[model samples]
Target: MQNMGGIFGILGVGCGLYIFYALYKLKSTGDITSSILLPKDVNPKTCKDKDGYIKAVAPKMAILGISTIIYGLMDLCETFVMSTGNFFWIVLVLVFVVLIWFSVTVSKLNKTYF
Candidate 1:
């Protein structure tokens, strides 16, 4: 029941950290040759400026990672501290908004640089 939420929260945090780590690697290595951020049809070889693209997209990914961590904390709170009421719905909506924003921004970045 409510305890299940703790598991999900931990998983979310793990995922967020992993994403953050990936971005760090991309930034440090400047390796755009094989990036998950690149779209399927958008070839990295055709990118106008790989560094510029990463600079633009990395912040967006960071935002997404931070949002996921926040969502995870909220979920954990819902499981242990508070009851499943208004807060749950609000967090759910916020998660959706962040996800949609991330997707749209990434697509736009792909078009802008790739």
Candidate 2:
């Protein structure tokens, strides 16, 4: 179980870094028309200012990615040092909360931007 936490931490960090890199590339190129980050059916050309739209959304993606990395670190710490039963429940609850928050954020982004 503890090993799982470490694995998740590594995976989360890797995913977060990848997201950051992708967003950075999008920002640098000022091209929002065709990006892996956007939804499949979303046409960036529909937006009035594609560059501005990308610029606005990139920060949100960065924040989400950073939060994921932080959650992974917290999970790793909980696994190593807080394995008591009560602490376990607390961590589980925290995980659920994070999941819900992340889902809501993504949904909102989709609704607002995509």
Candidate 3:
């Protein structure tokens, strides 16, 4: 109905703002506050340190981006799919838990190194 347009607008703005904030923090704090939390898909050798440690930022950002999109997708799906009981709640919880864990783990690991 009329609310769908408003909801779409809000989600678009929210996604844009989240990206803007993350990018700004990356520049100002030198820390990517948000990254994709995903299993690496590349060759292990490609991701490494001097000792060949498998670590990278792209994957994290990709995961984060995917998660954000999923949240919106699921939110919309709820209206059509009665099986998806209140997607917003699940998405909200997942977002908070995943982001908190990801941010903390990344920051702690960073401190241990440089």
Candidate 4:
């Protein structure tokens, strides 16, 4: 179980970096609208300019990526702290809570922006 925490931490970091890279690509190409799966009520045509669309989406992407990175760091810290035989369960709970919060935030952003 302890080793698994480290693995998850590494995976989270990798996933977060990939998300950041995708956001960078979208911003550079000025094609954020096409990259996301927008809701039915939200039409891409509503966004008149490519720059504005990218600008709107970039912050959400950044928030998601940063939260993921923070989760990863917390996971790594939990792994080490567990080895010391202290506050293991508390840290684990915190990780799950953070993960849930991140998911909910992303879902809301998807509905609002995408």
Q: Pick the candidate with the highest lDDT.
A: 1
Q: How many pairs in model 1 have backbone atoms within 3 A of each other, for residues 3 or more apart or on separate chains, i.e. clashes?
A: 0
**Whole-model lDDT, model 4:** 0.64
* C-alpha TM-score for every candidate: 0.80, 0.61, 0.46, 0.58
What is model 4's C-alpha RMSD?
A: 4.8
TM value for model 1: 0.80
By TM-score rank, best first, the candidates go 1, 2, 4, 3
For model 3, the stretches where C-alpha displacement exceeds 4 angstroms are: 1-54, 78-83
* Cα error of candidate 3 at position 87, Å: 3.7
Model 1: lDDT of residue 51: 83
Candidate 4, residues 1-114, lDDT tens digits: the string is 674758887886787787788887887765443434354566655555556556655776776677667667667777765453445456546556755765576556555554
Clashing pairs in 1: none
lDDT of 1 by residue, 9-34 (tens): 88777868877887888799866634
lDDT values of the candidates?
0.79, 0.64, 0.51, 0.64
Q: Residue 95 error for model 4, in Å?
A: 7.8
The alpha-carbon deviation from the true structure for residue 67 of candidate 3, after best TM-score superposition, in angstroms, is: 1.1
Better of 1 and 2 by lDDT: 1
lDDT of 3: 0.51
Ranking by lDDT: 1, 2, 4, 3
Stretch of 10 with least lDDT, candidate 1: 31-40
lDDT of 3 by residue, 9-81 (tens): 3583467457556645554554434243222443322322412111444345445555666666666565455
Measured by TM-score, how close is model 4 to the native structure? 0.58
- Superposed on all Cα atoms, the candidates' RMSDs to the truth, in angstroms, are 2.5, 4.1, 9.6, 4.8
